[model samples]
Structures are given as structure tokens and as C-alpha cells.
Target: MINFTLDQWYGWINAFLWPFARLLAMFSVAPVFGESTAPSIPKVGLAAVIAMVVAPTLPPFPALATSSYEGLLVLAQQVFIGMALGFVIRICFSAVQTAGDFVGLQMGLSLATLYDPSTHSNTEVLARLFNILAMLVFLVFNGHLLMLDVLIRSFTALPIGHASLNPAAWMGLAELGGKIFSSGLLLALPLIAALLTLNISLGILNRAAPQLSAFSVGFPIMLISGVLLLTVVLPHTPSYLNEFYQEMLGHMARIADTFAAPRGGAN
Candidate 1:
């Protein structure tokens, strides 16, 4: 004999559906988990599994029919929250790629690009290389686990169906977006300065010895120097990436708090 009332069914559904919506939205944008080449079925399944695990811990859902306007609005809020959080982490990878682009341009490898399935666009060769390294660094530091933990904590900070997201949160996200350039430039600065000095020296040599072809001599020298510099630079990069991930995790928490706070209130 099986007896299940409609209210009980709604309770079960509410416990799972909203959380599932948020998790699915997050996986749609998060790095590695969200890669375009990855099959969609796994993402959906993983979201479902996580939603099942998280549902029991969630606070009771507000009294609203799933098909009602208010319920839909809440659902949209959850999706937005998930996507925004995932995007915040995605920015970390973008910063690394940006640094690579700067270095590659300096090294005359700007034209050497490949199709990046994750972005669905062509990216500079060095950018792709840096992205791969960043992915590895992220895994080494258990960033994926941290990301999941943040998502879980977000329920406590933002909750389900408390839908008034602060405008300042969006503003903050926009501001954080600007870090792609600033952080990237900082990362590439040492190499950029060295390469600029090398180019200057090459220019002076060319001026003093007009017989030496700049194209033949300067190009090879620059290429070799860039390779050597990159080898030296990369060993130090994991440390920088570790710090960057820690900072980004802090930002994620702050953003969740911002998302939960009342408009114009201190977060």
C-alpha cells in the first residue's frame, strides 16, 4: 500500500526542483564541468545527484505553487545566482589566459591560435597553454571541491526564494570583471619588461650594424629568448595561481553575501 498526499509530493518536488535548477545553471557555466565538448547528460545527472544531497538540508520552501508567477521569479533568481557564481570563478581562468596572450604577443606567437572548445572560439596558442596549466593548478588545489562547498554555503547566505538580489552585487561583478586586464598585466609584466629590453637592444644592434638583417637575426633571438623566459616563468606560476584561487574564493563568499543583502545595506 502506497499513500502520498499532494502536499507531501509538493514538498518533495520543491525540495529537489529549485536546487536542481540552480545546480544545472551553475554547471552550464562553470569551468571544466561546463566545457562544451563534455556531454550534457553527465552534467544533468551530477546536478540531480547534488540536488538530492542538498535538498534535505535546505530550509523549507515558501508557500507558492511551482507554476505560479512568484515561484517562477524565485526560480529565475536561483539560476542567476548560480550562473553569476560560476562566472566569477571563470574569470580566474580568463585572467590567466589574458596573461598568456600578452606574453604570446610579445613573443610573436599571437597568430598561432587553436580552437578552444570551452569558449567555442579560437584562442591564442599561449592562451590555450596557460588555460590548460591553470586547469591543472586548479585541480591540484582542489578548487572543484571548494567551488562545490561555496555553492552549498550559498544556500545559507542567499537561500531559496528570497529573491531581491542587491543591485550592488551586479555592480560588483562588473568591477571584478575588470581584473582580467589588471591581473593579466601584472602577471605578464616581468616578461614584458625583459622582452622590451631585449627588443631595444636588438634595435640598437641593428642600428650599429646595418649589415645584420633584423628579420634574420632579431626574430630568432627574440623567439629563443621568449622560450627561455617562459621556461623560467612557468615554475613560479603555480604559486601565483594558488594565491589567485584563494583570493577568488574570498570574492565568491563576498559576492554571495552581497547577493543576499538588502539593497543599500552593508554586506
Candidate 2:
């Protein structure tokens, strides 16, 4: 008969629980998995499945303590690491939404808000539309799988209890945040520039004929031009989204490297 001591059982359970808790925390805030619309039971089940697959591949943990407090601390650490990784991807998606919001504002559609089920908040219609489009493109480009692969590889690169948020990593994440504005501005530039020229022309026309109400005439013109510009720009959006996704992946990889690197060296 196999003889397992109490300590041995505690160790076994701790080993499993550590990674499981971490994976659960990760999925809890991850993009699709974290969405408000996702059913909780399924999300928890998925986390368990992931933890089981990944636990054996993880680095060995220190001897488990019988105290529940130690286990909770371990669980908290894992949750933090998972949340940081998931947040990086979430920021990337925010870039697309940011661009959409800007476009909506420029096109005078800022007031058109819709209920976003995923977030359970009201967001600009254009932002929601672009977010959906970006998601589809993300799937088409195999980005979802790539992200999962990255998350898995992160364990090997920056193993649990080994990872730390370095200054360089924080700087890189900050830089990544800046890209949201840059990408959004880039996506909205054409429309903005076109509108500027159209408004200037309308101003000149109004000056030449005071009888014409610029509000009436220019409003429709602006709307039509904006719609036309969007139609023309629609085909190019996938390319932009693809580039954004690639950049996000690269940024995440760099962050992982920073975390994996020796502490207090060049970032």
C-alpha cells in the first residue's frame, strides 16, 4: 500500500493550486475570457483545464507550507503576474477603440452611444463597431492563438516566483500606452485632414454668400464626405489592425524578456 504523509499531500495540492489559482486570475481579466458576457462556470472550467495542462510544464516550486496563509500569498503572486500579462493585451485592444472614438468625434457621431455587452457600458457606436471588426481581424490573423502561445511560453521565459516588474518593463509598458494615441491619430488622420479642408471651403463659400446657412449646407456635406472617406478607408483598416497586433505581440515579448532578464542591468 502506498503511504503518503500529510506533508506529501499538502505539497501535491499546493503545487496544483498555485498554478491553478494563477491561471484562474489570468483568465478572469483576460480579454474574451474576462468579458462580462462570458459565463462564469465555463470560464472557471477553462482555467482549470489550462492549469492542468500547464502545471507539469512549470518550474518546480519550493516546498509547500501547511499554512493556508502561505498558499494565499502564492496565489496572490500568481494572480498579479497573470493580470499584468493579460493587461498588456487589453491595452492593445484599447488602441483600436481609441481610434474609433476619435473617428466618431470627428464625424459628429460622438453622441451616438450603444450598449456594449462585453464591457457592460455605453460606448460610441463607431468604437463598438471598430472593436468588433478588430476582433474579427484578430481571429483571421490567428492572433488569438498567438496570444495563447505567448501566455504559455511566458511560463518558461519568466517562470512563476521568478518574474518581477522591472523598471525597463514599466517603461516599455508606458511606451506601449503612448502608442494607443499614436495609432488612433494615424487611423483618424485622413478623415481629420479631409474635414479640415472641407470646412475651410465651406467657410469661404459662406463668406462669399451670407444668404447661405453654412450650418445647413456644410453639415450635410461634412457627413457625406465623412461617410465616403470611411468607405474608402474600410479596406485599409485590416492592414492597420494587423500591424497593431504584431506590434502588441512584439511589445509583450519584450516585456517578458525584461522580466526574465537579470535585475538592475540595461533595460
Candidate 3:
């Protein structure tokens, strides 16, 4: 039987360690897995399991060893790469949340914030509804599968030890952020215009009858009108969610391109 020396065994274990560490780092900070609501023990366990599965499929280990500072640098780079990918997806989801917040504020539902167990932050009621709907739609459309596919493809496109950020890619991510305002405004436009009309009408009524309590009269009417408008627009939400997922996948593809580009090449 073939025999391995102590140094050879150490080298073999080290070879797996770096790749495993990189994968763990990626999963640790990546959006869904990185959320604060996720238990630390489970997250660590899942990361280890994923690393075990993915490490063998990856390219050969880089020359860097865990014993050196360079290994730590590589670990950091891997984590950054994974986090950047997850962040892009997170930003896309935030567009819907932003739109919901704008709609809630315009509709006088600003005080209706609720604790979101997923994100562990208080979110507008409308935003929570939309976010939950978006997640459901994402699963319904197999977007989660697509996301996993992209992550797997990343291994080949941007192998281990090949982490580097592209400026153009970053600019693209910034542009994605800019879409939030546009999309949010678009989603809120109809409601905003209707509210403005109601406000103007109330103003006229107030001017005509000083004895009338505008606040008392206007609040219920506005609330009812907002509810009716939301009902009317509810049917369109699925279409918007579908579009958002499509855009998200496209952005992920762009990120892949950015990560896959040569060190000095354009994304």
C-alpha cells in the first residue's frame, strides 16, 4: 500500500481547508444565509456542509497556505466576492420594499410599521406584504433554483483564488440602485396623484366652510380611497414581481461577467 508522510497529509488537508474556508465565508455573509435571524450554529453547520460538497469540484488550491498571511488575504477576497453577489440580489429586493414604503407614506399608512422577523427590522405594513409576495413569487418561478445555478456557475467562471472587483461592475450595481427610485416612483404614481386630488378637494372644502373639521372628514375618506386603489392595483403586483425577478437574474449574469473578466479586462 502507498504511504503518505506527515507533511504530505498536512498539505492535503490544507488544500481542502482554503477552499472550504472560502465557501464558508461566502455563505456566511451572503444575503439569505447571512440574515441575522438565522441561527449562528445552523449557519456554521450549513456552511461546513456546503463547503464539503463544493470543495472537491473546485479548481486546484492556490499556492497560498493557511499558515501564511496571503491565505488570510485570499479568504477575505473570497468572502467579499460572495457577499457582493448576495448584495446585488438584496438591492434588487429592496426596490420593492422602497416602493412599498413610498406607497404607505403617500397613503397615510406611515404609522403601520411592523416587525419583520426575516430582516429583524420594522418595515411598513405594505412593504412587508409586498416583500412576502415577492419571495413567494420568486420561489414559484424557480428563481431560487436559478440563483443556485448561478452560484455553481460562478465556481467555473470565477474559480477559487480569482477574486477581484471590477469598476464597471460596481458602476452597474450603482445603476441598479438608481432603479429603486424610478421603480418606486412608478409604483407609487397612481396613488400619489389620486391623493393629491383628494387633498386639493379637501382644501377647497376647508376654504368654503371654516366650521368643517377637515382632519376628521378627510382621514377616513383618504383611508378608504387608498384601500380601494390598492385593491384595484393588487392584480398588477404579480406582474411586477415577475419583472423584478427577471431583472434580478439579469443583474446576476452581469455580475458573473464582471467577476469572470481578466484582471485588467472590461466586464
**TM-score winner:** 1
**Candidate achieving the largest lDDT:** 1
Q: What's the TM-score of every candidate structure? A: 0.96, 0.90, 0.83
Q: Tens-digit lDDT track for model 3 on 1-267?
A: 999876676457655665556555655554456566779888778667766777777777676556678767776766766766666667656777787888788678889999987777899998888677766777788876676667666777777666565667766767777777777677667777888798789989999999998989988888888889888987777787778777777787678678668666864
lDDT of each: 0.89, 0.78, 0.72
- The parts of candidate 2 lying over 4 Å away from their true place are 66-70, 163-167
Clashing pairs in 2: none
The candidates, ranked best first by lDDT, are 1, 2, 3
Model 1 spans > 4 angstroms off: none
lDDT of 1 by residue, 1-267 (tens): 999987777668878889998888888988888888889998899999999999998887887777779878988888999999988889998999999999989888899899998888999998999999999999999998999899899999888988688989888989999989988888889899999999999899889999988778877788899999999999999999889888888888889899889888944
Q: Candidates 2 and 3: which is better by lDDT?
A: 2
Show where candidate 3 strays beyond 4 Å: 1-31, 117-120, 205-211
Which rank order by TM-score, best down to worst?
1, 2, 3
